[model samples]
Target chain A: MSLPTLLEVVNLKKTFVRRSGSFLKPKKTDVYAVNNVSFSIEKGEILGIIGESGCGKTTTVRMIMRLMNESNGKILFNGQNLCGLSDEKTTKVRKDMQMIFQDPYDTLNPGMRIVDILMEPLHAHKPNMTKEEKYQKVKETTEAIELIPAEDFLNRFPHQLSGGQRQRIAIARAVILEPSFIAADEPTSMLDVSVRAGILNLLLDLREKMGLTMLFITHDLSTASYMCDRIAVMYQGSIVEIGETQKIIDFPTHPYTKALVSVVKDLNSFIENRETMILDGEVDSTKKTLGCAFVSRCPHQEAVCHNVVPSLEQIDKVQSVACHCFGSSKMGISERSGALV
Target chain B: MGKTVLSVENLSTFYKTDKGISRAVENVSFTVEEGEILGLIGESGCGKSTVAQSILRLIEYPGKVVKGKVFLHEKELISASEADLYDIRWSEISVIPQSAMNALNPVHRIGEQIMEAILIHEHVSKKEALDRTKVLLELVGIDRERWKSYPHEFSGGMKQRVAIAMALACYPKMIISDESTTGLDVLTQSQVIALLKDLQRKMNLSIILISHDLPMVTSISDKIAIMYAGKLVEWASTDDILHDARHPYSRALLDATPDLINRDKKIVSIPGTVPNLVNIKSCCRFHTRCPFAFERCKVEEPELKEVKPGHFAACFLEEENHELTYTS
Candidate 1:
C-alpha cells in the first residue's frame, strides 16, 4: 500500500529583488530563485531534489523549514499550513523537522564540546529534564550514530574529530530530538569518497531507525539514484522532471534530465559514448522568462518552446515531465525512450 | 605507454604542526608517461594533493619535502635551484590548480592574464602574446570576443575554460590538474573533462588528473593510482584497477561509490576514520578499518607488490595465484 503523504509543497515560489546598476540609476528586478516548485514526501519515503548550483534546491528546503519566508504558495506539513503559523507555533512544528547542512565544519560551532553541541536541542526542548535523564538520552543517540564509546568523544571539541566524525556528530545532533522529517542539503558533498559513503549509509540507517521522511538535496545524479526512491530534477528554479529513480535514469524525458543522465561519468559508458551528448551554456537564473528556461541550451528546442512556458505534466503513471516537445516531435518521448532499450 | 615524462621516487613530504610532525606524503613513488593521463584517486587527507604539491615543489612554510627525487623527463628537479625551477614551472610543466575556476584575477581582463602568463615564460612581444592568447582561448572552445571581460563577467564553465586556456598558453609537456572539476555541475564537469581529453590528444600533453571522484578520473585516465593515508596502495591500468582490484582499501572505495546500473548492490562504508598523520604507526594504515585485516596487518606494513602482470596492490591478502581472501 502507498504511504500517506507527510509533507506536501504546493506552488512554492521565492523571488529576490536585485537592486543594481549603480546607486545613481538603481534598477530593481525580481529574480525568481524558485518559481512554482512543488513536490510531496510520504512518511518514511526519501525524495531527492537533484539540480545544479543556483537551481533553487537550497532555497526550496529553506522555505519548507520556514527558516526563510516564501514569496508565495503553501507548505503543508501533515495537513497543516506551515507558512500561516505564528512564530511560536512554527518553532514547535520545526522540532519534528530537522536540517543537515552541506558543510559539517562550518555548521558546527568551534568552541563547544561535543556534549554541549548535541545537548543544546535537548536543553531548549526539555528545559525541566533531570541531568541524569539528559545524559542517558544523549548517550543513546551517540551510540545510535555508531560513535563508539560515546564517553571518549563527549568531552572532545569538533576540531578534535575528523571530517567524517564531525559529520556523524552533526547527524547525531539532528536525530537527538528524534525528528520525523529531515532535510539534508548535500550532506556528503564536502567529504571524501570513503567518508561520504559512511555519511550516506548513516543517513540511510537513521531513516530506517527513526522512521524519517527525508528530502535529500544534491547535484549528483549517481548518489541521488542510489539513495532516493523518487528523484525530482530541478532546473532554473523549476522541477523539469520527477519520477521513480530507476525510470528517470533509464528513460529521461526532459531535455535537461536527459543531458544530466548522459553526463553522469559512468566508467563503462566512457569508451562507447565518449562524445554522446553535452548541454551547451551554463544555467542563467537571472532572466525573466515567459517560456522554458532551458531553451537557450536545449538541443531539441522548437520555436514554440521559447514562447510558451511548460508546466509539469504527467507522461505516465510513474513519470512526469515539464517539456512541450517531450512527445511532440521525432526527437520526442518515444524516440528518446527507445534509446534506453 | 609512451616515454616516462615524469618520475617521482621515494618522495616524502612532512608538515611541522604545533602538536607533532605530520607526514602528509610518505615515500610515494609513481611515473607519468608522455601523452598519457595518470589519475590519482584518494579520499580527503590521504595526501593526494600533497603528492602533487611535492612534485611541483610548491610546499610552503612548515612543510617540506624531507627526502626524495622528482625528475622531469630525466632532469632532477628537487636539487634544481629556485631560479631554474621558475623556468620549468610554466614552460615545461604547467598547473591548472584545483581552484582555478575562480583563480583568475578579478581586477584584470581575461586576455591580459593569459597574455601575461605567456610573456612571463617566453620572450614574446605584447602583440604576439595577445594573439597567442586568442588562439589558446579558441582552442579551448571559448569565445575570443569575451577576452576583454573580467573573471566575474564569465560563468563558472567559462571561467574553467579560460583556466584551461591559460594552462595551454605555454604548451607545457605536462599539466597537473588538481581537482579541476570538484565544484562544477555534472554537465559542466563532463564538458571540461571532454575538453581536457581533446586537448591531451591534440597537443600530446601528459596530465596528472588528481581528484576524489574516482569514476570521473577513471573515465579519462590511462592508469589509476589509489592513495590512502599518505601512501600509494594500488596502481594499475584503469580497466584492471576498476575490474580486478586487489587492495582492500581500493575494493572498499569502489564499493563505497554508489553504482548506477547495479541497484541491488548496497554501499559498504569503510568503518573508522583515517589514521592521524602525526607519528603514524608501522603497521598497515588501512588495517584498522579493513574487514579482512589479519594479525600480520596489525604488526607490519605491506609494500606494493605486483600481484598481476600490470596491476600492483599493497596488501597481505593477495596470494601467488592472485586470489583475494577478502569477500566484499
Candidate 2:
C-alpha cells in the first residue's frame, strides 16, 4: 500500500463526434468513449480495470499507450505529462510503457518468424547493438516464456504454434524491452482455461522477477480477483467502484458492482442457492445522459439517481463507491439487507 | 423415467487438412434425456463444437463423421440421407449458434427470419406463421414490438433472444446451444442463462449446452461432459464433476478456474499444450500435460469407465485409486 506511484491517469477523456443528418447541414453528436476517468498505479502493483464491452476500458488503455490521443486530461508517467510530449520524446518513453493486446493472432504478424518478431523491439530501441546481443535477448526471452529449447521455435511462424504458445510469444515480445509498466487488455480472454492459467502464473512470476507494474483489463470478475491487487469496476466510461480485489468481491458497495458480483457464477454454489440478480438492460455507452449512467438498470434507483451524477466517495480506507444509495434507505432490497447480499 | 431425447455413441469425426487428417472428435458419446440439460464442456479447439455439429450432421466438406450412431429418440441421424435429414433438422433437433449477433440476417426483419424458419420446417399459413413468430419472441422474453426491427437495430442480448426464438420456432425436442452465451457481457450472459432456464422449465425442452466456461456451465447444467483433444474425458452430474472430478484434465481445468468466492485457493494451470490433432497417437491425449501421468499412459489410451454409480472418467489413476495427487 505504501508503494510509490508509477503511472497516474488524471481525468483522461476521449470523445468521438459523429456527423449525422443531411450532408448540407449535418449535426454532430459527441460519443463519450472515455469520460473523466482517473486512477494511479504503483510500482509492482497489478491494478485491474475491469468492465464489460464498450465501457471505455479499451479507450482508457489506448489513451495511456498514446495509440489514440485524448480529447482532455493528462497521463503522468513518473510525474511527466505524456500527452504533451513531442513525437520523438514519446517514442523514447514508449519503451518504458508497452501494451499487450487481447487477440494474440491479430497482434502478431503471421508472415514473420518468432525470432524476428521478438527482435524488432531490440532493433528499434537499441539499433547499434550487435546481432549477437539481439539474438541472445531473443533466446533468453523465449526460454523465459517457457518456449524451451528456444531453437525449436526460433525459425517457426505463428501459424505453426498453438494458441497457448502464440500467447506466450506475445508475452515475450511485450516484456523483451523490460518495460516499467504494462497495459494488458484481456490478454487471456481468447485463451483456454489451462492456457489462461499458465499465462496468469507467468505474469505473476514476471512481475516478481522483473519488478513490473501492470494494468490488467478484463470483464471476468474471477480473473480480476485472482490476478489483481486492486480492481476498478468501470461502467459507461466511468469507474463506479474501486477497492481491494477481495473487498470488492466480499463487500461490493455500488449497485452495479453488486449486480456484477452476483452474476458471477460461483463454482462451489449449488444451483438452488445460485442468486439470480438480473439487470434490466444493456450498457448504453453512446448516450449523453445528465444523471448516473446505471440508473436505467439499477435495482435501487430513485428520483435523485435519474437527475444527479454521483461522484466517488470513500467508504473505508481502501474502498470507494460512486453510488447515492450506498448507505441510505433508498435501496430496494425489500426483504434482505443491502450489506453484502 | 424420462425418455432419451438424444443419444450419441462412439462418434468419431475427422477433418482432412492439407497436412493430414485432424481428429476433431474421436470416439465421443453422451445422452440428453427429456427435460434434461447436458453441458458439453471443453477449452477452445477441444472439439466440443464439432461434437454438436456432428450430431446434427452439420460438418462441412473437409470434416466427415467417419463412424458414429447419433440417435434422436428412436431415429438414426447419421444414416439419414440429405432429404431425410432436412426434414428432421429444425423440427426435431435445432441449434442455437454460438455467435447470436451474427446469426441473424442483418437485412431481414427479426419476425421474417423466425417466420422463414417455421415455414421451411412446417406447413403453416403466413398468418399463422406471423402469429407464431410473435409468440416465439414473447417466449424468449423479447418484446413483440421489436419483431419488425432489423438485427442491427436490436441489442446483443435481444439478438441472442431472437436466435433462441428461431431455434424454438418448430418446438424441437432437443436444442444444441453452442456457446450461446460466449460473447455476451456478464450481466447479459446471466440474463440469457436465466431466460434459457425459464424456457426449459415452461416448455420441458431438452438442451445440450456447449461452452468452454466450466463455472457458467455448472450453473444451469444437470449433467456435465468434459472434452479434451477431441475425446470425452469425464461425464457426471454437475455437483459430482465440480466437486470430485476424476480425470486429470478435468481436475486441472477446475483448478485453473478462478472462483469468485474461493479467493484463497491458488490456481494451478496445467503445463504444456494440447497434443497435435493430426494423426494423434494417444494412449491418453492429456498424458503430456497431466501431472499424475505414469508409464502406462504412454502405452495405452484409457477408456472412459464408471468410477462411481453414475460418474465416469478416462484415467488410469482414477481406475486405481479414484483420486489425483497434486505435487510438483
Candidate 3:
C-alpha cells in the first residue's frame, strides 16, 4: 500500500455572508470562494498550488492552517482531523504549520526590532523557554537562513533592513519551531526583479537542508516548476488540473493551464509567435457567478459552457484535468481523456 | 523616415540629501528618434524614472539636473526658461506618470480635465476644446460617450488610457510612459502595450517606455538601455539585447526572468541587492553584484562603448571599437 498522506482535503468549501438586498428580507448569499476543493500533500513533498490572485489559493491555505474555518468538508493534517479540533488544539497545530506571506514590508511589525519579531513565534508557542535561550535560538535560526552576522541584525528594526532582509526574517520566524509544512504565498512578488532569483534559490537550499515540505502558491508556472515536485492549477475555487511538474509543464491539459503556459516570455526561443493564447479580463475577486468563472473569457467556449460546470477527470495515466474537451496531447508525450460521455 | 523628435546628452541627475548626493543618473546620453520606441530599463533606484523626469524638467528641486542637456526637436531644453519649458511640456513632449489614479481631480469630469489641458496649451474656444477632448478620448480606444464619466467610474487599465488621452490632448510629438504597465497583470499589460504601439505608429510619436520587465521591453522597443544605480550599463537593439545580451547585468536580468520556453530550467536570480545610491562611486555601479567583476571594474568605470552594430554597453570586457554606435 502507498504511504499515508501528510495533508488530505475532501470536498472543502467556503462561503461568505453578503449584505442582502432590500426590505423584503435580508438574505445570506453564498460566494463559493473555495467550492468543493479537494487535494492532499504527501510527506516532505513540495506541492505547488498555482492560480491567479482571486482563484482561492490563499483561502485554501488559510483553511488548511485553520486561520479561517471551512463552511463544509474535512481537513486532515498529519493524519489528524484539523477541522474538528478544539480552539486550544488548533492553536497548537498552528505552531507546526506556518505561512510566509507575500509582502515582506507589511508582514513584519514596524514597531518591533528583528530580535523581537523573530522571537514572537517562539514566545507564543513555547512560553516556558528562558529569555537567554530565546535569544540564542533566534541567533541560530537567523543564521540558518543566511541572514549573516546575527548581532548586527538583532538591534536593527524591520524598517532599517531591505526587502530581502525582511523576507529572511519572515522565513526565520516561520521555521523557528521548524514547522513541518510552509505555505509560501507569492513570497517574492513585492521584491525587486533582480533580487527575486536569490530568494528562490534560498528557498530551494532551505528545503534540501531542512527537508521541509512546502505548499508553494504562485501565479508563475516556471517558478512552480523550479520549486515544486507536483502542481495543482486552481481556477475559480476549483483545481482545474493536477500532475507532476515536468508532465504538467511539458503537456498542460486544461485550457487555462495552456494559456498560462503559453503567456510566459522565454529567452530561449527565437520564434516570432508561439500561439499567444492571452487570457482575457481582469481577475475580479468579487465574482459570485455560477458555472465556470472563465467562461466569459474562454476562447473555445460553446453555448453549453455557460450552463454547465466542468469536473476534473483522469485525463491521462499521470495527469488529471478538469475541462469539457479533453483531446489528444499535441503539446508532448501524453493523451487527453476523450469527449464527455 | 520620422524626424528626430527628442535628444538628451550627458544627462546626470542627483538627489541631494543630508548624507550625500545620490547620483541617480551619471553622464547618460541617448537620443529618441522620431516615431521610434525606446525602452529605459533597470531595477528600482536605477534612475530610469529620474531620467524621464529630467528630460521633462519635472525633477523637483533637491533632486536637480546637475549636468547634461536635453533638446526637443533639436531646440535646447536644458537652459530653456520655465515659460519655454511649459510650451514644450505638453505641446511637444508629454508624460504619462504612474499616479494617474490620484493625479486627476476627483471633483472634475474627465471631459473638463482634458479640455482644461487643451485650453491651457492651445488657444481654443470652450466648445471647440470639448469636441477635441471627446475625439482624444476616442483615439485612445475609450468611447466618446464615457468622456462625461468620472475617473472613479473607470477601471485601472481604463484610467491609464484616460491619462494617456489626457497627455495626448495637445498632440505632443514625444511621450514618456513611466512604468505605466508595472502593476497590471499580463493580459492588461499586453493590451496597454499594444495600444501604445498602435498610437506610436499612427501619430509618428517618439515614445520613451521605462520599466523593469526585460521581456516586455525587448518585445516592444526598437532599442533599449539597461540602467543600474543611475548608471546606464548597456544599450542595444531589442533583438541583440534580449537574445545575445553581452553585458553581465543584462544577461543576469534575462536569466532571472522565468523561462517560458523551457519550464524545466530554473531561474537563478542575481545574488545581492542593488547597491545603495547614497553617494556617487567612481567604479562601475553594478560591479558589487556583477558575477564577472574584475579588478578594473572595481577601480574605474567603463564608458558605454559600441560592441556591435547599433548597440552600446558600458562593459570592460567588450571591445572598445566595434563601429555600431550611430545606427541608433
| DockQ score of each predicted structure, in the order shown | 0.62, 0.62, 0.41
Spell out the clash pairs found in candidate 3: A197-B269, B24-B230
Kindly list the per-residue Cα lDDT of model 2 for residues B274-320, writing each as its tens digit: 88899878679999998888899998989889989889888899766
For model 1, residues B1-328, the per-residue Cα lDDT tens digits are 5799999998999999998999888878888998999999998889999988888899998999999999998889888899999989888998888876468999999999999989989998999999998899989888777789999988887888899899888899999998988888888888888889888988999999999988788878999999999999999999988888889889889989987778668887788878889988788999999888778889988888888887878888885344565554
Cα shift from native, residue B205, model 1 (Å): 1.6
Residue A244 Cα positional deviation in candidate 2, in Å, after optimal superposition: 0.8
Off by over 4 Å in 1: A127-129, A265-276, A338-341, B319-323
Off by over 4 Å in 2: A265-276, A330-340, B321-323
lDDT of 3 at B300: 93
Candidate 3 at residue B312, lDDT?
84
Per-candidate TM-score, first chain only?
Answer: 0.95, 0.94, 0.88
lDDT (tens digit, per residue) of candidate 3 on A1-341: 16558888998999876677787887766676898888888878889988866779999989998889999999988888998799999989888889999999999999999999988898899999999999999999988888788998998989999898899889998899888888899998788877787788888888888878889998777678778888999987899999888777777777777666655543112122322343335555456655666776565665656777877788666679877655633332343221110
In lDDT terms, which candidate is top? Answer: 2
Per-residue lDDT of candidate 1, residues A38-112 (tens digit): 888889999999999999999999999999999999999999999978999998888899999999999889999
User: Which of 2 and 3 is ahead in lDDT?
Assistant: 2
Model 2 residue A205 CA deviation (Å) reads 0.7
